[model samples]
Target: MRRGRRKFDDDEADFVKRGRIEPALSEDPDLPETGDRWSTWDNALHGPDPLPEWVRTEHGAVDTELGMLKTGKEADVYLVRRAVPDTDKVSLLAAKRYRDGDHRLFHRDAGYLEGRRVRRSREMRAMTNRTAFGKELIAGQWAAAEFDALSRLWRVGQEGGTISVPYPVQLIGTELMLEFIGDHKTGEAAPRLAAVRTDREGLEDLWRQMTEALSVLARTQIAHGDLSPYNTLVHEGRLVIIDMPQIVDLIANPQGAEFMARDVRNVANWFTARGLRVDQDELIERLSYEAGLL
Candidate 1:
C-alpha cells in the first residue's frame, strides 16, 4: 500500500553508475527469465493507498502479457497478468501505452492542449509546431494527464460512493497500468455503454449515474471533454467513465463551456432517444453554474 516514487538500491545504483545496466529482462523478445519482463513496480510511480489487495507489488513479480484488450487512436490497452513466480498472487492490469513519434495521431490534440503548458519555451515551440519530438512530448503529457485526472477522480469516487473508475495502479513514462475493469477469471472486459442493450429501468438508472458523475466533475471545475456512451462502461449495472486524456479545466480553458455543453448534449441525446426525458439545456445550465462558468 506504499505510495510515491521508489528509489533504486545502492547495489543497483552502483551497477547503473558502472554503465553495466542493460536492457530490461522483460524487453527481450525471447521471453527472458519467466514473464515478458520483471515487475516495473521497482522504479515506476506507484498509485495512491490503500492499494487493492490484488496489486502485486513485490520485486519478484513478473508481467505476462495476456493479450490486447482495446486499441484506439492514441493508445492501446493490453491485458497483463503480474504474478510472483511460484506463487498464486496475481493481478490483471490494463496496460495503456500511448503511441509515440510518427506512429501517433494528433488530430484532436491541439484543442485539448489549450490550457495546459510546458516548462520550457523550446518544448512549447515544438509542441506548437507539431515536430517529431514535440509529438512524443505531447504523447507523454496525455498519458500523465490521464493518470493525474484518474487518480484525483478515483479518490473522489472512492469517497463519494457514487462514481466509479478503474484504480490507477501505476504510471511509467507513457505507459499507464490500471486495475482491469472486467472478469479477471475469464479476461472478458465489461461492455461499453454504447454496446449495452438495457431495459427502460436500466436506462434510467444509467442516466441517473451519468448525471451524477457529470455533476461531480462540474463541481470540481473539470469536464470529460470527449465523453460519450462509447467511452463509458456498464459493469453490473454500474456506470464507469474512462478515456479522460482530454479532460478540460472548466475555468482555465476559454472553450471549456463549449466542451462541457457538448459532453452533456452527446449523452443527453442518447438517453432522450432511448425514451428517457433528459433536458440537455437544463443539465448544461446546471453544470455550467456548478462549474462557475455561468
Candidate 2:
C-alpha cells in the first residue's frame, strides 16, 4: 500500500534525496521520481500539451504520491508532493481520483442528475440500468461536475465573496488535482465542521461565516444540495464548502426550491442543536430572494 518508499537492502539510498512523503517516511526507489512513469500524477507529469501556466512556472515539477489522505465510497484522495526535479519549489496537491474500474462502490446518484444532460442514448440507458460501464461513466461525470463547480465558486470567491473553495488545478479523466487546503508541509487535513465544538463566541463566529457562505451560493444561483456539517471544513477559522458534485440548480431543477429549503434547514438544525437560536424561516426567505428565486 505504501508508494514512495523503496524497500532497500542498505545498498541504494532508502529514500529519494529531495522528495516529500506523508507521515515523514523515507522514499522508494522503485517509484519513478518524475511521476509520469508512475501513477502519482495520473501520468500527466509530461503531456502532449504543455502544463498549465501556474504549474509550468515551476519548470515541470515531479509528483510523488505520499499516501492516502482520505477514502470515501465514490473516490479516494491522495497526498502528493509536487516539486521541481531537484529544487525546493514544492506544493502538496490533493489528488481526488474517482473510481474508474468495474469495482463500483458508490451509487444512488440519480437525484442529482435531474438537470444534467446525458448526451449519448446508450450511455443514458446503461446508467439508468446501473451497468458496469454505467458506473464508470457516472464516476467520470461526478469528477467533472465537481471540478466545474469548484472552478465557478472559486472564481467568485476571488472577487471577495464570502464563499471559499479549494483552488482547482487540473482534471484528467477521473483524476482531479486541487490545492491542498491544509498545511502541505505536514499533510494534515483541516477539521470538518462536525468535529468542531467551540466556545460561545467562537460558535457565533462560525455561524456568521457559514451564513456568509450560504449567501454567496444563493447569489450565484447555486445550492450546495448536500450541505451538512460533515461536508463543511473549518480551516484557519474560515468556512470552506466542499463536495459539490451534487450541487443543485437554483433555477433549473424542478425541486430547486425544496432543495434550497432543505439545505438551509439541515444547517439550521445543526446550529440550533448547538444552542444557537436562529430565524431559520426568515433566513431562508432572505436567501431565496438573494438568489432571485423570490
Candidate 3:
C-alpha cells in the first residue's frame, strides 16, 4: 500500500527508477513472481532489440509494475504507479493492459458494437477486417473511447451529487493508466455492486445512483453499451461505474435510446431483487426527461 522507489541491485540500477512497490506473492507456487520484474516473454515482447529507440526512451522511463487485479476476456487490469520526476511523490494508478488482437474481435462483432448512429460502412468494414493496420487503428480507438467515457462519468458525477469516479491519466498503446480505485494498503479489488448485500434503503440509494449515471450518459450523448451490475463498483456507499470501452456516441448511433433504456432496466432489476420496488419505466422516463431527450 505504501508507495516508494523500488530498490534494485547495482546491476539493475541502469534502468529508470519508478516509484512502485513489489507485489506480494500468493500461496500458489506455480505462479510466476507477480511484481515489478518482467517475465521472459515480457522482455521478448518489449526487449531492447525489438523496441524502437524512441518508444524505449519514452515508455521505458515511465515505470510500470504488473500483478493481477481483474482478468477479463479483453484485458487484465493491474495496479501501476510511477514517480513524478523531481519529486519524491508517487501517483497510484490502474493500468488496463489490453490483450493483443482484441480489437479485431470487438470490431468484428459489429452487431454488438453498432449503435443507433451508424459508422461509415467502409470504416465499419475496415474495422471488422483483421488487417494488421486496421487492428492497430482499432486498438488505439478503443483505448481512447474508454478514456472518454471515464472522463465523462467523472465530470458528471463530480457535478451531480455524491458519486465518485476513478481519475484516468493517459492511454499508452494497450496500457491505460488510471486512478487506483481500491484501498491501497489491503490490495483488495473494489467491491462490485453485484457483490454487495444491502438493505432496502441502501439498494434504493444505489438505484438512484445508477439512474443518475444513465442520465449523465444521455446528457453527454454517450451510451455505455455494457452497463450492468458487474461493471459497477460500490465504494463507501457510492456507485462508481467501470469497464466502459464499448461506450458509444448516442448521436452517432440510432439505437442509443434503446440502449439507455436497457441500462436503466438492468439497474432497476438488480435493485428489485434486493427488496427495492423499482419502476424501470419510471426510471427510464426520469433519465430521458433529465437528459432533455423526451
Best lDDT goes to which candidate?
A: 1
The top-ranked prediction according to TM-score is 1
Report the alpha-carbon TM-score of model 1 versus the true structure.
0.89
Q: What digit string (tens of lDDT, one per residue) describes model 3 on residues 1-294?
A: 999753322112121123333333113334333334222222222211222222222222334453556655565566654443444444455666666664332333344356422257765566667566555656666676787667666666656754456666656576676666776665455678877888777887787777666767777777677677777777788788887777766666667677778877776787877778878887778767765667
Local distance difference test, each candidate: 0.82, 0.72, 0.60
RMSD of 2: 9.0
lDDT over C-alpha atoms for residue 157 of model 3: 61
| Candidate 2 Cα outliers beyond 4 Å, as residue runs | 1-31, 34-59
TM-score of each: 0.89, 0.80, 0.71
Prediction 1 global C-alpha lDDT: 0.82
Clash tally for model 1: 2
> How do the residues 153-228 of candidate 1 rate in per-residue lDDT, one tens digit apiece?
8899989967788889999998999988888888778887777888999999999999999999999899999898
Clashing pairs in 3: 116-253, 116-254, 116-255, 117-252, 117-253, 117-254
What C-alpha RMSD separates each model from the true structure?
11.4, 9.0, 12.5
